[model samples]
Target chain A: MRAHAQLIFWAVLVAALALLPPVVGVLHEPFYVELVRRVMIFAIAAASLNLILGYGGLVSFGHAAYLGIGGYAVGILSFYGMNSGWLQWPVAIGASALVALAIGAVSIRASGMYFIMITLAFTQMLYYLGISIEEFGGDDGMRIKTRSQFSGLIDLADPVASYYLVLVLMFGTIYLVHRIARSRFGMVLRAAKSNEARSRAIGFSPYSYRLCAFTIAGALCGLAGALLANHTAYITPDFMHWTRSGEIMFMVILGGVASSAGPLLGALVLLVFETLLAGWTEHWQVILGPLLVLSVIFFRTGLAGIIPGAGDE
Target chain B: MPPLTLVFEQLLNGVQFGVMLFLMAAGLTLVFGIMNFVNLAHGSFYMIGAYLTLAAVQWSGNYIAGVVLGLAGTLLVGMLVEVVALRTLYARDHLDHVLATFGLILFFNELVAIIWGRTLLDFPRPEWLRGHVEIFAGSRYPFYRAVVILVGLAVGAGLWYVVTRTRLGMLIRAGASNRTMIAALGVNVRLLYTVVFGFGCALAGLAGLMAGPIYAVLPGMGEMILIQVFVVIVIGGLGSIRGAFVGALLVGIVDTLGRAFLRPLLATMISPTAADSAGPALASMLIYLLMALVLAVRPEGLFPSRGR
Candidate 1:
């Protein structure tokens, strides 16, 4: 919780992520590169979710829909041979933003469990939409023939290039969230979350602030989704499932909420734990499930709280 | 147009589906209303109930007996989960409840898979219950489905009497309205909550067992209907029993009817090929769209609980 502690935490995490590739090269564990790339991509998503869910107090259970939408944006485009990142990535972000606009416009009016369920309903709606589209293989999903292209500046097909790309984006997202959390906009959003009536009395419309936060989070998560598609080179309706959203939410909570670096650490720990557990046994969920329950019960401060300092971000 | 008899059959199917949903939603709403706790794992009870029935029926060779034992087992499991994992979570944030219950879901699912070998299990209907019955001058219906309807209606009636007329029901209503105040009075709110939770689990188990004969019973079966049940509770009003029933029936009927008629309806307006493709997609999305529409008009639901 200390300021310097968080600084050190982010610094170490960035360096470690930045330096994972060569280490993988030395260890001859090429699979780990892909695994950590996934972790970083989701780290971007979890951090974005923390932006709304932690900082603004909006529990949008359908966050994964943006992932699906973003993935599909790149996917459906690539299906038509538009593998260019310039077109695909912006379309991914924009489409997700537009969908978020529609969903948030309707569901943000309600708060608490209603908000949660409504968001879930909307996401499931999109999941069905994804299912009904047969051209891209519907529920079976589609394989990405090529990762997004960058007009010769970069190639997502290259593993190291993709790794660094994800790393840069993840760090940017976390820093952007940290900045937003300290801004005037974040103060109003947090105020509305803590006391809606008081914030409204103070003339800050909670609706607009929360909607803005929700859409921004959705757009950011969409980028993560785009990366997720590139990382896996496949897109499926499964990406939009409510449980996937729950997993992302878990990353935010497991990492710690309202902290700049919490989502990054959380994604790293959870996915790594999963990888290790899966390697250990076929019934890895048996252990992971109870562990999640116990952690939610006991780990109020999350992995971030384990640090010596306990008060900062 | 479809034959009138086919329409009748679909109507009956819709009601049967509605009846099962009511059973699942009833317990959820009671717990949701009274404890203000959201149990995402409620569907686990349904799954366990179905698995228990499959195992018990095989062991006992009696359908009714298997169902009874399964319900009892589900009740016990519900109590154990309530005491061991959930009691402490009552005072925590809903997010904590979501996380914890979600964990329970994962644990129970894998545990069930471990025990049952992860293959889909089927529960056979009793020989007598599998016959068809003439319900009207020309209409014949499946007896098992009729039985499901009867059981659901009977339970709904019993629930109505209990909540409206009985002393325990009075206490449940009081606890739902003011848990602290009920505790302040001589009532042991804790025992009441466990009882409600267990009873709710039993209802869910009953629904699950009955559904086993109708749908494929599998480890994660609970979650498939669990979302629909949540939609029912949401549309009916979170804590209100009347709302749960109405909402359940509405969702069930709309879903069934939509799947049945949407293709024909769309075909009449568009190309048959387009309708064929679009129908299934629209059908799957029907209930969710209904929920969205309901929320748009009445954000608190049709029968919002008082004293929330």
Candidate 2:
């Protein structure tokens, strides 16, 4: 039954995507393609967060800082006339990883609110730094004149091509996370989340495993940030703001933590709600706030948590 | 031009800023320490306080009345939030608290924007407190700012007295130390929590009310101070009242002085252009850098919870 469900899920996903473009073409409404692309981008970020929050039991309030780092990587490099994919991608990932490692080292030692506060402070530091960089446009932000070039393979300047590229990366990330979750390393992570003392008794340092998970999550979110900069063709200090981090965490909760595909569903619900509600009224957040409160009250498992056969193994 | 006068002026500014931060941080620490709830929406209460103060001042035709109404309004809202949303989250994890409070932040910001409009509101200092008073032979400070410092010090003393000398304060301290034990003692834990929450809200509201005249009464003003408040609580030592007071003063002084003096100091050492470039950026981060240093040396904070 599980196998059948998986097969059906994959089939539906493929069929929907394959038919979506043509359907939109028939209707002469292709804007949703861009929306779907956005959903995918946010999903990548949410999923990365899930790896730490859900499996590793680390709730970081500052995950969006990595997204900012990733975006800044692209923006700063491009500003300096180094727009090659090889140079840009590695530098972005490396910078994000270094930050994650340093922050995670000190932060992982503190549990609960202390950890949350530390992460928040570090992220705010980044936000202020971003604002202070007068050359990078400070609070105003920097506009990318052109997207990264990938030596004759990917033309990121083309919207459709960039959308497909993001989609591919999204799929690749999902697959990688899935494999890691099912592996021995993932077993220790889950164990640590469930019972740190027991995991310690088993001779696994929970801190190291958690740190590894956090770094990996940061790297993935950074990649999403890079894609996001490409998507908007602009990067701002707002990307790294604490509020952005809150929004991503909202996505994680709305989708149901610990469940695969939860973040994607949550991102879709939030973005679509945001778009539709904003269209209806300028005070869309008022509606959203109460709705979110109700959702948390009623659906502890989130939107994905309600679906049949959606529980995590 | 005298160093003594310069130092005195900076000290006064530091104390004023510190008191404001204490108003914000005190509530945050109390809620977290007593209830074990990590409320990201505490800042929203501060925002509400500012907005309410603005409205109250307009309606009452007096700034003092506005201040009272603002405090009362925030207390009411805080209690309502506790009874409605936060009570359910008590049994849940910190993640739930973080997310729900985040939702509240979004909700409150939008609600304020809807009611007050997007443009920033001017919270006028009362005519009585508008002028400056001379503190030293040559230096003068705003009378309103002096009032803020005095009020903050008074509140801090009152808070200290209540926490240390009163029955409710004993209950709060006890609750923080051990909720289960306190619950077992037949105290109405829920009611206690609500009262504590309301008290914290009132403190935040007071901060907001006082801040209105000094800072722009805007939709997201609370957000700017929220992180700084967090840093103060962290440095003071989570769940420690004495820590919050000391921490607030430390952070406020360091931040204000850093911004005021770092550029000049750097200019004296380095080239003017370099100092000009690096000064503001470094000034902005000085408090956070101090926090990181504090956390590094003392992971639990300057004054951690006793026993565990």
RMSD of each: 1.4, 1.6
Which candidate gets the maximum lDDT versus the true structure? 1
Give the number of the best model, judged by DockQ. 2
| DockQ scores of all models, one per candidate | 0.71, 0.74
Q: What tier of docking accuracy does candidate 2 attain?
A: medium
Alpha carbon deviation, residue B135, candidate 2 (Å): 1.8
Residue B256 shift from truth in candidate 2, angstroms? 0.8
Q: For candidate 2, what is the DockQ?
A: 0.74
**Model 1 TM-score?**
0.98
Say what the interface RMSD of candidate 1 is.
1.2
For all candidates in order, state the fraction of native interface contacts they contain.
0.61, 0.65
TM-score of predicted chain A against the true chain A, for each candidate: 0.97, 0.96
Off by over 4 Å in 1: A308-313
TM-scores, all models, native as reference = 0.98, 0.97
A186, model 2: CA deviation in Å? 1.7
| Model 2 misplaced regions, further than 4 Å | B1-4
